[model samples]
Target: MNQPARVLRMSYLVASLAGVGFFVLSVAWLGVWPARRLAEDAKRTGPGHVVALTPSEARGRVIYAREGCAYCHTQQVRFTQADIARFGAPTLAWETRADTPHMMGTRRIGPDLARAGGTRSEDWHLTHLYAPRSVVPASVMPPYRHLFAGGSDAPRQEARDLVAYLETLGRARELAGDEGEARAATVSHTHMEGLTPSPVLNPHPARPRRTGEVPALPANGDRARGEWLYARNCAACHGSTLEGNGPGAGGLTPRPTNLAEHTYTDGRLAQALWNGVSGTAMPAWRDLPLADLGALVEYVRDPRITSQLRHDRTRPAQGELAFGQRVYEANCAQCHGAQGAGDGWAARALAVAPTNFRVQRLWGTAAMRILQTGIEGTMMASWRSRLSGEEMQAVAEYIVQLYRDEQDLRAREGRR
Candidate 1:
């Protein structure tokens, strides 16, 4: 019995020692070793060097954490098929090497922020931060209005800093180019080694890729349904009146098309809705049913059917027209084309093509506004400094007359 008691005591001691040894091993293997490896890897991997956050970016990161932006937005792109399909290649471990706490958020209440940089213009961000609904009528994300001093047009220093920080989010990865991506693929867990990665990962991956072919429209469309759809989707950017003066229009570069004045072929509408306009903030609505898209097109083609409208009914006074004609010849003809066809000598060089005034009927007041403020995101510059109010009004009136002349000429030719 005493010998048995001695054996039991010895076994108890051995067990305690074994437990202690296991704890030490776990700490070294699971904690210390991994941390050291990560540190070393940070020094070597990613664009071949560590990407230290700039002072402004660091401050912005602090703000991002404090604001709980991570609660809604995720920074990590997982290895799952869905994530890879949507966010481009799987995120490498070394990609977050410079991140101190890391912004790999737990949930995705909003879109991923991993590839947000350079996807949108600065103005779009400013307006969005000020009032999400202003630009995206259906956005569930809350606005960061406090970031602005007054209007979206006038952002405070903090706002600028925040945007600057935002602009840096996916910049390094994009700047990494193909070589950096290839280097990362070799060491990353996802085994994306050797294959060339897409140069620019899409920020809004929910949108369909451009297929170059317009989706087919339904055989027949309901104008009423199209009206409702237009109000829901197009009105925020294109304006409720189709005048291109929506609350969000002011912020967009290449301001939203004045749909009422601009005539588009059915094919152009289909293509724009299906693939979105490149180099613009317009998003593809491929998720919508074909019938809905057809209706949207129908409604956009003739918005006047659903609602009563008001326009300047009075024709341009002859003196006003004569003065406008003189102004058009001297100043506007070079860019607007002699016949207002948007085929001016300089039109070829412009990124966003000039407006063809002959095809569409512009609101006189809207034309004056364009002259005063200039269309943002295009070659058009504000004439506020160059022309007097009377001259601006005269030129705007002349532009309206161009459409009238074209319509009258077409009517006469048809009769003949």
Candidate 2:
């Protein structure tokens, strides 16, 4: 039997009220709740205080967005093994709270930059910005010529502002230091609850260089292979002919080292290649094969090829060695070690290990220059204000004499 159907319908006022309630619930669930969660997370894990961007940094960020820098580079480090291996820990919920729209892009045409701060010096960033291909031969990024006054050396204000902003990327997290890192690690996730940072404990490899000794370099590397590698990797800042007068040298004060002017020990080359020269534009090349590094050592140490960046190799008198030792003990020993072994009391505290003079020797002219100007990035400061030029020469000579094998070094230098 077909019963008479009756339609049950709410009155207009009741229907309107129910629909409005549902809409409100949806908004609270989808929008307001997540925002509140993020705010609380920010308070917990963020660097103890909020830092507003400076005017320059703000402007740079605008430019960064306008230029679509975010399109290729991602700011977020996800909680995946590969991401952590390449880009440090996963980006915390609090890290980007200050970001207006967020620069966390999805694509990875370039490496993540959430922690790019202090990893590279300003010069490297500027050089990379002005002409990507100049420093990195395989870069696909287009040149930002408009940001420069002319060449890379002549960066406009906009360029500087952009770099300034980049420098602030991970500053807060790093400054929060160990306390903040601990806070971030406590974040509970389905996959990462109470676990450690990554599959490997190594830091990001885009690198300011690892401090301490480099591993043993390969012996008898092919010089031809090294020369080819140098042409590609080293010839830009260091001239094609090794003259230290590459087109980019105009921008760097204290300038790219004239590798050809001075002789280097095998150990010295190993340190420079492995750890990079501290406080200078020289960066680590540990990414290269050990064989490649050894080959480079061969070409660089070859006397015939050196002297392209000729400075007077005239050395101080042998009599200065005793005086030099005195100066070194009195003033240089605390950091360079009493015997120039780079194991001084303060050496471990420094970001870059002091040069191991036990194995590496700086020649006369080069040593004199390093004394007057100082190595900008390392603990080595210019002694010009404290020591007389003669005293500096004495100390420099003392360090040179500390070379592990004096006869081998003399033979390499072609001295009797």
Candidate 3:
């Protein structure tokens, strides 16, 4: 070969060798680093730390692995503002240290499952698994009812196990003792970018006349009546205490709302009872007697009853104005205009425009009805399927309160 050609070949050979060296170094370092770090974390966190799983929970893990749940659900959390904002904090490195086969799953066919534990009560999950559309009207998830033998005991056991496994997630922070203050602080300061004022807060909030005060029961609104009604009509899903812990909670998406955290007025409560929140698991109680429905509403709204069930009635940040502004900003700003007007980015894309909350009637007679129906004639969809009856009521009340406050502010300004 000529000298120039030989030199060129020599240089090419050197460069190729250097490239090989770099690849080898990378492979070795990358392979070892994560394994070593994971080991160290495991050592610090310990393994075989029992998480109080029932036999069903253990079985459910087998099913979860067998079904390739990892394909669609990732147990790990990513560190992103949107993710943290939407699904709480990112996964901690040491939290999964004890996992024999780490559940840092791949894909996101559904929301992340890292924080599934206690995020919802058990019954919600069961209903979801049986029929995804029954609970989340918009879900594309397939039903898993075939896993059970047409409502036999076998599926129930498997469901319990799955729930047990899910319940173990998100307990890491609680285990670490940072849950109380950290969670509370996060909730307190978390700002939602765009939400509209609720109509319930209007000074001239539409006050629908009550059909009647719930008459005192012949047996003084017997607890037995509530219990019987709960077991026969409600317990299959909402647990004994209306805490959303019934047998059906496991399979649901967004899950059932815990009823113990809500307070509702008689009128608002009556509306839900009379007309079920459309597009959800809560069917209309139209078939029920008005008196029975009224009693049920009272049972649900009674502070004593709620307190007995461990319900939370803490008001949102402030009076309707402040809270409604925050709610509108955080939840509505993206779809609705930034100014509580209906001009949003997706407005044109949608079949219908979001309502202008500033309008009196929009925040008046139809406010609760609209919310109950969700965004009509479009993909905005009803929240009824996702939120519980009590939650819907609370949100409705909050909206009216907001409308009232705005009107009051306007009135004060006029006087000035």
On lDDT, the leading prediction is 2
lDDT of each residue in 6-119, candidate 2, tens digit only: 222435667888899999998999889978887888787787686778999999999999999998999988877777767777888888877889999988898888988777
Winner on lDDT (2 vs 3): 2
RMSD of each: 5.9, 5.1, 20.7
Can you rank all candidates by lDDT, best first? Answer: 2, 1, 3
Model 3 lDDT per residue over 324-379, tens place: 55555565666766765556676656533454434322223244455666542345
Residue 49 shift from truth in candidate 3, angstroms: 5.3
For all candidates, what are the clash counts? 2, 2, 48
Once fitted onto the true fold, the runs of candidate 1 whose alpha carbons sit more than 4 angstroms away are 1-7, 32-45, 50-52, 188-200, 203-222, 249-255, 274-291, 305-373, 382-416
lDDT of 1 by residue, 1-416 (tens): 69988889899788999999999999999999989876665544566664677898788888788889899999987766567656776666677766779988989988788777765667778888888898878999888878887788778877777877788877777777778766655566435444445334553532433345676898458888988888888888888888778988776777677778554545556767887655566667766788998988888766774233436558878999899988887888778898887778987777555666775556536677789888777778999998888888888888876764444466799999
Q: How does residue 414 of candidate 1 score in lDDT? A: 100
Candidate closer to the true structure by lDDT (higher is better), 1 or 3: 1
